[model samples]
Target: MNARLLILLPASLITAPALAQGGDSPLDPLFTCRDIADDGARLACLDAAVDALRSETESGEVVAVDREQIEAAEEATYGLTIPQFRLPGLSLPGGGEDAELAELESASASPQRVIVRDTNGQIESIEGLAVAEISENRSGDTIVRLANGQVWRQTDDTYVQLTRSRADTDYTATISNGALGSHFMRLDNGGRRFRVERVE
Candidate 1:
């Protein structure tokens, strides 16, 4: 284990800057130790790399996020336009002028409720979201709060009524990306569809 760790130093030193600038990954150094030929040198390298990584993490220069955290972030930011930028220690798949970091496929237990992304890796649709609460604004616009804490507001004048007495599970919806950056929410119970914009 020590030898394997030592091999990491030179590779990490060589790769860390490229990773920082090119949107690769600092975590690559953790995997580079296997290439070292000398045992003592490999152990030293790994030790140095590990120390650097620990320091970077403690100083907030690097952040570690698991799959669930990333998915939660994706869900929270869905239906919104996020400007492209690189974050340290968060390298995403794909490359090119128009390529985007592909989101990890959702591991939600609900078989039918999964986040779907478009060709550009933008969220295209989310299915089977339970309605947690519903209300109306002073302007008579309907406001819906989903179980995941997302808030959506009705944008059109269409009059539609949802049964308030039904269980929250009975008020499921599927929201999809609509034409020209618009969004539409379709209720599974009544098949009622309406234009909506995220309010929170």
Candidate 2:
């Protein structure tokens, strides 16, 4: 899969002149709040900062997600070569640090039918071994830690009870996108499917 830059920084920060309390730029909120000696005043300053942050989010000037949402989204998108909003870098697949560097066979090919290959040759898919370690939270969500150092947590309310299939079983995580641009990761042979979000 090809990586695309999906930046969501506030456009005002990028294009507007520095904000000012007067003609000169005002102190940055984080920096200014740190200098407040009075506890109440410091808290009020911090509140203002939080209000600014919320306004940025509400105005669609910044892309923001809570920790829970992010954790869910991450688990669902593991193994997919997702676009990042950070720096300019190589287009890489979504996986843990132990992920193998695989290349897309053809960049000009069709979208969903992406073919990935390692140094050896073409690969079936991004593969991971289901380790003995697993857990289910009170919310009915699950987290699966693979042997390859990748941790996949089940997002949403979907529940997939695991089976002791094998002592050392390898699982396939296939990423497929819908026409509406939604992506789904399916664990092949794992009885149930989850709206998983990759957190690792």
Best by lDDT: 1
Over the stretch 12-63, how does candidate 1's per-residue lDDT look in tens digits?
Answer: 2222233223354666775687578989888988998899898876664565
Clashes of 2: 9
Which portions of model 2 show Cα errors greater than 4 Å?
1-132, 168-170, 178-182
* Candidate lDDT (C-alpha), each: 0.61, 0.44
Give the per-residue Cα lDDT of candidate 2 at 165: 71
TM-score to native of every candidate shown: 0.61, 0.33
lDDT, model 2: 0.44
Query: Lowest-scoring 10 consecutive residues by lDDT in candidate 2?
Result: 13-22
Off by over 4 Å in 1: 1-22, 30-41, 80-112, 118-122, 161-169
**Residue-wise lDDT of candidate 2 within 1-200, one digit each (tens)?**
65443333442332112111113222267578989999999999998987886786566555432333222223323344452211112221332222222112111221233334346432333433334356776776777655444556675666565557743234444543323334344555666556655555
Pairs with backbone N, CA or C atoms under 3 Å apart (clashes), candidate 2: 74-197, 74-198, 75-196, 75-197, 75-198, 75-199, 76-196, 76-197, 76-198
Worst 10 residues of 1 by lDDT: 95-104
Best by TM-score: 1
